[model samples]
Target chain A: MSEASVMTDELRKQIGVAGEPLVVEMEKGMLRKFVDAIGDPNPLWSDEEHAKKTKYGGITFPPGILAAIMMVGNRPPIEIPLPRGLDGGGEWEFFEPIRPGDTLTIECKIGDLVERQISMGKAIFIYHDTVWKNQKGQVVATSRTYGLKY
Target chain B: MAKQLYYEDVEVGIDIPTLVKHPTTQQLVKWAGASGDYYQIHYDKDFAIATGLDGIIVHGRLKIAFLVQMLTDWIGDEGKVKKLACQHRGMDLPAVDMKCKGKVTNKYVKDGEHCVECEIWTENPEGRKTAPGTATLVLPSRGK
Candidate 1:
């Protein structure tokens, strides 16, 4: 959440670093649930003994999970006045596998706005860059998302 | 661990195995909780309808994961998923069959590493693509 004034602050607060990077704990339970939700039946994501034999040394969430790591707490709404929003897609880069028990810092930087008209309506392709770093400060993953603000 | 996929063994235009996903409302709720995307449109039916959307829609990110799984599953143990990107062009509703499909578009030796690029996507039952994307992966060569 941003510590800012209500009105103009909404824009100001979100324009910058987009508030503090959320700290997320990749607990075992959460990873398991996420694995199930994705329908990934791989034992590397659920089986403890199996994961112990692998290079990751334990269960890990698929790299795609990093794209949404900012959801640990209540995320303040984006102030864009566009009525409907859709995901325009993103470039996600994974550096290291996200394992259970790892703590991550998620940083988001907005302001890559390209306003253009689409069939849906007047849409702005809002780009957001987010990086996830582990407690050791190693960058685990990075993502650039184009959110369609319409 | 699955057997490592060798780069030399793969060829361009080869279809990787398909992974079919059934996105349920329960899974969306779990994704919303774990991923921290509490968007009402993803899990709240009434809220989504009020917001001019059809009933609860599946999260785009979830579909992206399905695509990733399609690659990672075929790439196997020694293979590495280097880069991936996707665009959400359509909405995916719950209880529908979403097929994750992909094929190798190119193969090359980059910095002495055998690499393959694949075009991947998830299609709804009507056969319209919901999420289309690309992925680059490095696989071990048979000799190396």
Candidate 2:
């Protein structure tokens, strides 16, 4: 049927793979707001003195907060011409906590694309895997996020 | 010398205090700044709606982040969140009053660690469940 073929046509071709060594900076205000927005009152993310008493030794975001540092389409070899998209699912692995004022670089790889259609529209799933490392090149967290293009 | 909740302290039918979070476009944008997620679907409403979505949709990870924070705050640093999973059940429209809730479903001990499993969900003002999932955590011993 035409619909099935169109669905297949909508399949996203991996036009490109994002480059590695992508670095991102987190400002203090932004980190504070994110912690506040999530209502995570833990001193770990805000209080430098309190954080110093812990293993991390300074204010730091939660391990899961690494999900915030992945920048899609920000650099070379990025996916081209995506029309519609949605966050489908993701998997996370934590090695260490991310701290404020740390400039982190993400090592990234583009995964296979999946195609499908529904009442909403024809959708293409773009999958990306990334590893976050602190300025010291220590791996902090890794994640794979799936986004849909319709 | 931290405390851990026991399986005996929790009941199957008891409800955990619900948290309601209403994420606005500004908030999502701020999340973008903090998280480095530039997917236009989160910021560009016109383009987002053109895709047949009612409006811009919140990042699935952000929603999970909220859930994670809630569970972590409840369990504390001495505890560990072993695993959490969620299925995208509904759309979260921007600036809408959305509610997040969780309930204790199961409890047990493994490797001498007390653990609790909870059912979590987020809903819209219309009372429609958007994100539903399960979370597993290892709590410290209650006597510690």
Candidate 3:
């Protein structure tokens, strides 16, 4: 078997087992930072009064902002020992606006391992999926990201 | 309220305003702080080059974020982003210019909700598509 296959098999074994649901509380500051960093000037994401006049009732985090936090949460804790990795790719589907004060519970799963060889070294790619739901049990978003490790 | 771009206002061939971003190492670091993507490829030039890339590359997710923002801002609040998908086509290096632009490609109305479909892409200084994708958004209308 290829080195990537071996690593993937080990990773599959690690699995983190069953994914534990995580509750992410939406905050305006985090949302604003993302908007500013991305250079988005949409008033709906930054303006409350204007947003309230819309169908969404009030201000909401843009879909990309919703995905950004989930990507942030996918990292290894600083204290943990881990190998370096590359970001291979990602995909996301937005089902609803992520409103401030809304707590989102995510259903996460580690996907299959994909292997690719590069001049640098042998790289293993893994896909991860996270589904976000609101306190009302309504599905809000689904985000998938790919990470590469040597 | 600003006037919403209705299905009547958009045509399949019209171009939308383009977005430009000056990606620097610091910006990547800042994005890493917010994104929690500590992958070496984003910040380590030597490591990235080792991976066969000329230099450190921007995160694919970050590019996707910019594309989504471009569309939603154009469609306005009453508009809803229905679907978005992108395929990475090139690499964006730090201290380089990346331009994002889009064009309306399709339009339709379903159950009283008007929708406009757009084609979006990012270009490097060499004028190559870095990332290309499509988005479907629901645009508000006047009435029945």
lDDT per residue (tens digit) for residues A34-99 in model 1: 777787887767888877887777777777676554432223357676667677788887788888
Better of 2 and 3 by TM-score: 3
In terms of TM-score, which candidate is strongest?
1
Each prediction's Cα lDDT score? 0.79, 0.68, 0.73
User: Individual DockQ of the candidates?
Assistant: 0.68, 0.37, 0.49
Task: Give model 2's share of reference contacts.
Answer: 0.34
Model 2, A1-150: lDDT tens digits are 135543333333443456656677766887787776565677767888877876567877765575553543243353434464556666665566666678888777676666667566666666777777788879777666666766
Sorting all predicted structures by DockQ, with the top scorer first, yields 1, 3, 2
**Per-residue lDDT value at B50 in model 2:** 79
Measured against the true chain A, the candidates' chain A TM-scores are 0.80, 0.75, 0.79
Chain A vs. native, model 3, TM-score: 0.79
lDDT of 3 by residue, A2-93 (tens): 45243534555644443667778887877877777676778888888888888888988888765564533433321112356555556667
Q: iRMSD per model?
A: 1.7, 3.2, 2.3
Query: For model 2, how does the per-residue alpha-carbon lDDT over B1-144 read when each residue is reduced to its tens digit?
Result: 123344556677667567677798888887777666777788998988776777788877678777777666666555666656666667788788777778988888887868788888787899887878777766666565
Ranking by lDDT: 1, 3, 2
Question: Candidate 1 residues B32-121, lDDT tens each?
Answer: 876767888988899999988879998888888788888888987567788999998889899989999998999999899898999999
Question: Relative to the unseen true structure, what is the C-alpha lDDT of residue B33 in candidate 3, on a scale of 0 to 100?
Answer: 74
Off by over 4 Å in 3: A1-18, A69-85, A111-125, A144-150, B1-3, B44-53
Question: Candidate 3's residue-wise lDDT over B1-144, tens digit each?
Answer: 346766667888898778787878887887877765677888998988897778898877788788887677677667788877777666788788888889989888877768788888888899998888778788766663
Would you list the rank order by TM-score, best first?
1, 3, 2
